[model samples]
Target: MGTKWITFDLDETIMQNPFGKWVFPEIVNMLKKETDTEEDILDLIVSEHLQRMSEERFLEAYDWDDIITGVAGNLGAGSVIDIERMVIKHSESPKIYLLEDNMLDYLKRIKEKGFHLAAATNGYSKYQLPVLQKLGLDRVFDEVITSDSAGFAKPNPAVLKKLSDDGEITAHVGDRIDHDVLLANKLGVFSVFIHRALPAEVLAYPIDERATHPSFIKICEEKWHKENRLREMPFLENECIPKVVVQSVEELAEKIGFILK
Candidate 1:
């Protein structure tokens, strides 16, 4: 291969979603004024959301808009027009943090070593691009490919294959085994799985008896969805296993350097 490249997954791998937890709360507040009791409305919406998540095929067919529409239907709420606008606004300007300290510096060092970097993620450019710009990584990657732009999502090798078009992809790093590792293994690229601890906000969020129950919170935490996908998918025994596993992004940086050397 003439040039070596490394690809990174965006959401949980490079950035933490602090804004995610607030999305439900914002939706609840928007609908609260329509109902006589605010707490009752919140609890009802949470319950409806939990019911949908508990379904067998939820993970495979999950869509936020659909979930919100169901919630509105269940509550007999007037219209989802305002709710849709709110969701789009929140999605466009997500408040996020780097998963590791000095992540930008680490990526810069990797670039200095002459390795092309690409961001292969399963989101729209409108949403993912803003997060990159906020992280000051707007110009970091040689290519920023998303599901909307690529017409393929993770666990489908085509997403990663796009990066391989310009050069050989030496490794792919991400937080999900089902999506990220599976595709990398299929493509014969080194798969590095980075495990991030759940954020304190997620762990410490008060678990109310109804609205913010454990099951409801579980669906809210994206990490839970990742783990659930691993369990649900059939490739865990063979095809989806990662070549290396690290607890933090700092450790991932160290492992990447050692592996490439």
Candidate 2:
């Protein structure tokens, strides 16, 4: 099959966002201000942060005020409104993103291989475009389309169709299977999922030699829920499992190298 275009997701795929990198410290301090003594709230903060990170759709269902109200009540905070303000302020911290280690060089090598590159991410163009520039990728992508610009977001056929209409065979890569892999499979394009690594327990089992067991989708869903059970699994149709799952950007680069070659 013809394949030329290679698009990527932004946040976790090409960048690393440390746990509570933006809000944890501010939230802790804000809570401490209302109480004379600090309570053991770090676990609560981490749980809330992980919920926000893993449950993408759940966050949109409610506003920050609602989120803060629930979190404050759970934490028994002195001021709900004040905590809400702090939460909103810290949410903006994602704007300060750091590129993955040697990701620039890795992407450059792909470009040198003559494959067209693009970024298809879910966010407002106003915020997303700056992150690319900050990561020195504004010029790297031949095209960068945001949900706001496209009038749609990931897992939306409209966005994928728009990219496919370019008439270049294409593949989309990302860390999340429910979005990236499902969308690629729906469009009948190559699906390359880049997982960081196998779980410690499963690491010993050779992926190639393992007997029939849980699907990758199941494995990821379990981990996702365990880390953030507040949100339900986006689990789309199992019919669209990724054609390839690699452990790192380097492994993906090598696979892409084969495709381009």
Report the number of the highest-lDDT candidate: 1
Off by over 4 Å in 1: 1-3, 35-63, 78-95, 196-226, 229-235
lDDT of each: 0.63, 0.61
Candidate 1 residue-wise lDDT, 150-200, digit = tens: 777776787666667767988888877666877788998887766555445
- TM per prediction: 0.69, 0.64
lDDT of model 1 at position 209: 19
Model 2 residue 260 CA deviation (Å) reads 6.8
Write the residue-wise lDDT of candidate 2 on 1-261 in tens digits: 434678888778886432246445665666667654456656655455556556554323223344555666766675746433333344333544544567877887777777778888765565455456656777778888776677666666577556577756467888776567766777777777777756554444444322123555566565445534665665444534566666666656765756434
Q: Clashing residue pairs in candidate 2, if any? A: none
Candidate 1 residue pairs in clash (backbone atoms < 3 Å): none
Score residue 18 of candidate 2 by CA lDDT. Answer: 26
Clashes of 2: 0
